[model samples]
Target: MSMTVARRPHRLLTMAPAVLALGALFVIPAAPAVQKGDDFLTPETTGVLNLEPGECFTDPEYSPAAGEDIVLYTTCDQHADNQSYGFVHADDGPYDRVALADFGWTSCKRGFVNYWPGAAGAELDYYPILPTAETWADGDRDIMCVVYDPRGELGGSMLPRAS
Candidate 1:
């Protein structure tokens, strides 16, 4: 007498999809989401340096078209009289959805990072940052200006501080 055992290889394959979906579901909860919207600045709104309480503009540092990149000079100060702290500068991109922290002349931990604005219909995306480091400590600044490169392409949309 002889006996045979049948193995279901397709069962393993079918399980693969489920495992991947399950993993993605868990990852979705911890990620930041970005949204797309209109610009808060009008062409008539001049004097970005003398902006009002809820005003902002994009100061172009670098710009690339088609096959070029643009870096921008940005300054954000919640306090409108002196542009002392809470300032960020990104000299490396016309990139989409990249945020860089300006650490000044030192090799501070800075780099492009992604952020998601919440409240409804959230999304998952990424951006750029400069000098990325984990052990960075705040050196005395209440407001920090991050060079925002929104994949949503809403870079000049007057984003507020992350609360």
Candidate 2:
């Protein structure tokens, strides 16, 4: 006996709309959270000083005015890994790297993204950029810092008023 396979006919009426809908859903673009002079900052990125929900954040450097505390609005949380919890520099080139020195934590790590959480506002526990501490320490003092909280954004975004 020969096995006769029936071919399924193509149905555009039912399939086209479904395909289009799926495409549209997947193709929907989310607005970029971080931009120059923009309030939002990303946790994944370390160089940016501004914090934004759905974005990484950083604090500006305390230079020339070293030892002089920079007013920082940071997220609050205690992570198991010290590296994960504390602030970090974004990149090299002048703002080579650094984190706050005298450290403290607030109650909140997860802040409002579009919600723009209130900064715990602490004196940055800062340190200088050195090659030795790479493995142990985060990095050089960057004008950039981040607000890390796993609850919502994992990191906090800068408030509009912070700008």
Candidate 3:
């Protein structure tokens, strides 16, 4: 009697597409279905002081007069109150608050578009907190840019995903 050995088929090629699609489906749900909240500002934490790219935060009652910004960090999963998109800085020397505001508006808007392409389709809005005259006098030159949905709160990062 002669016996033959059978080899198992390669599951990788067949399963690869399904695995990627399943991953995409799981990730897609996190982006749009975030719940909005009335409590906008998050509690102060050290995370705020060291904000990084793609970090989400909140400072609803933000006030430059209160000294350094106290941000509350939160997961971008579907409960994000606000998101920090980018920052702009003033060139060396003194700049008027008005000029600074103008620059902030322009710079933040550009940052917003680049960070979140959704803005182009009216899917998002942006705001820039420019340094106040008092703060500017004290050498505060950072302009923080934020991306938010005016219609309601979001639950995820506004940033586009890598293909």
RMSD of every candidate to native, in Å, equals 15.7, 15.4, 12.9
Best by TM-score: 3
lDDT of 3 by residue, 1-163 (tens): 9989896878898799999988887773434533322122221322454666567766444456665546556777756757778778878577575676688778888887777665643767776666655556777777767777765666577777888
Q: lDDT per model, in order?
A: 0.31, 0.31, 0.65
Alpha-carbon runs more than 4 Å astray in model 3: 1-50, 59-71, 118-121
lDDT of 1 by residue, 16-77 (tens): 98999888877745333332221221112233334333343343223334233222223433
Cα displacement (Å) at residue 67, model 2: 35
CA lDDT, candidate 2, residue 105 = 16
Q: Write the per-residue lDDT of candidate 2 for residues 1-163, one digit (tens) a residue.
A: 9999997767876699889988998885755332222123222223333333223223344545455323233343311100122333333333212232211111123322223334322311211122223422444333232332222232222233434
From the highest TM-score down, the ranking of the candidates is: 3, 2, 1
Judge candidate 1 at residue 31 and give its lDDT: 32
TM-score of each: 0.19, 0.20, 0.57
Please state the error at residue 80 of candidate 3 in Å. 1.8
